[model samples]
Target: MGCFAFKSKAKNQRAAASGARSPAPTSDGQKSKASSASTPTRSIQELSDERGAQRLRVFDLDELSSATNGFSRALKIGEGGFGSVYRAFFRSAGGGGGGRVVLAVKRLNQRSLQGHKQWLAEVQFLGVLEHPNLVRLVGYCAVDSETSKHRLLVYEFMPNKSLDDHLFNRAHPPLSWRLRLQIMIGAARGLDYLHEGLQEVQVIYRDFKAANVLLDADFKPKLSDFGLAREGPTEGKTHVSTAVVGTHGYAAPDYIETGHLTTKSDVWSFGVVLYEILTGRRSLERSRPAEEQKLLGWVRRHPPESQSFRSIMDPRLGGRYPAAAARQVARLADRCLVKNPKERPAMREVVEELERVLQMEPPTTTAADKDGDRRLPPAKR
Candidate 1:
């Protein structure tokens, strides 16, 4: 889990001439975060060049620590298997006067397996990724020899917390069916980006659940947490094999059985997310009848076509939602959770399907739009 520094090919020559061995990859077999396409490679002679050293200044640990109050307890916002997340403010590296910028800093706990490797994974994936619904990686921090004792990652702070907090927390108001459907649409868009937008490198997000989907002020979902993601096959390779790593309820059944990961795994997980949105329930519910504890299992046994769909919709919404919209989302979730991953629709299809459903129904926002526009007159020359 220790951090390792990176050196360009040219730097190796000078180091060899100086009788020093090039640093090795971290023990976990994961690549360095700095090796991603976004990092510029420099030669040994270039290390002494102005550009090489200047590039290093993009991350200022001292300033980051200051922003987080030296990673203070009061700043702590959330925690997950990877580590603790703290809220902080980072100044734009461009020397803009320190304006307000909030960030979530996840500092890895020592006990976690693949601790540094996970950091590298997020760095490599998010550094170059740009998408509206995907959480942006503003920057990251590693354990230099001097700072090896601590590891940290920085991300754009989501003003509204994770979807899990709202869905499961009893104190919070039960999310309306309209809002939940919108959240699903937003999450599907994020998944669509990972599956289709990146050329040559297809990514399967290993974790797709309520907690990983954060909400913005407008309640648009931003998918976060690339720690569990894996690069999909290239050039006709059918699949990628890796240890099964994901939450208990969300892992696709086929992936669990074979350890062969594919884009369809994400589709299965999306089904679980959709189910959560529909029911206002967690993927795993122990309080329910023992036979009904597994959300997907329960939903599969009681498919939407069987007239059990009404019971599946969140009771908290008080049946206020349109029936057709509920049926569309239910059918979409059923398609995603099919036992055969091949049968599931791709994320793009899911997005389009949900959008079609939304468009078919009257939008809640349009009521406000209609009311506001009524006060204004038609433009006149």
Candidate 2:
């Protein structure tokens, strides 16, 4: 795959990091090395004035430090390529009389691969794009001065952590078939909004995977980490030619080969996660046997009609899930993973398919239902 084949050497270097943020220049001298590289034709400043009017609050460093217990290890909730995230609680300005809010604070490491530019990109995207499925950005801090330099962001805390925590971590109980389907549908809605919801720009969530999907207390899924998001091609353009930057297994093959990205690329990543939801397996497991390392390739070998398809379903389900629903989802996955980008169904179509799968089983009338707890019945379609 020509994953690194950029139009120029500078572009190649800019796309080097798997999760490189947009190359918008920051106030600090740390301007993006590839600021002039290919990008969506529209400038960031061109975003709607209404969005810009809702400016993010600038927090005092001392207050944030207090909130995070001086960035203590005990409060740390997550760590990734960007930096360390901490769980914190902040009270309203009036002290105890005012309500308290829970938040996740991300402190960017000065030495990390992503720096000021990426930080700015996160603020720019999340600052404006508002959706029920997209994580809310509360505020930010940029301490760029001659003495001390620090970059941090505050977000609404997701008590349930990430989808990856539930799907891949052995400590948690396995997600029920109904819950898994719900989560996938929620994620699809988020992607659909990004692809078509905005009036001025088509936002391509370059990084779409389970790890980036956060779940709330009620198991509602929200898309987080907008550092890799990009504006899609304008009218008459087929794709936005830019550097390839995303997680390994979830990125679309066409994007990897040509650096040409479209909404279809996000669809490909969505398909990978759909399979992960179905099988409870990671998209890329290096330790597995060669044939089984890549979940998509291995699962594709067993078409939904084939008897071997049962072998690919999550063993944890113990055959409790509806077979017809599983088969329908598997077919949708096949459509999303097609080699040609054009062949992949749009996010809207994917949402409709998932909704249809949800309707395949009739409502339950078991004792659980009478008690006001309705559980999905086995596949009878």
Task: Report every candidate's CA lDDT.
Answer: 0.69, 0.76
Name the top lDDT candidate.
2
Q: lDDT tens string, model 1, 1-381?
A: 112223323332223223212332432222222112244332222222322223322244566689889989999999888889999986666676767778788888868877756765665556545687888776655434432344577787887788898888878766765567667777888888777765434667899989999977666678998877766653445566778889999999999999988889999999888888778878888999987788877777766777777887778776767788877788888898888988999888998888778666564554433432232222111
The parts of candidate 1 lying over 4 Å away from their true place are 1-58, 91-99, 145-148, 363-381
lDDT (0-100) at residue 258 of candidate 2? 97
Error of 1 at 295 (Å): 1.1
Error at 356, model 2, angstroms: 0.7
Q: What is the TM-score of each candidate against the true structure?
A: 0.79, 0.84
Would you list the clashing residue pairs of candidate 1?
A: 10-44, 11-44
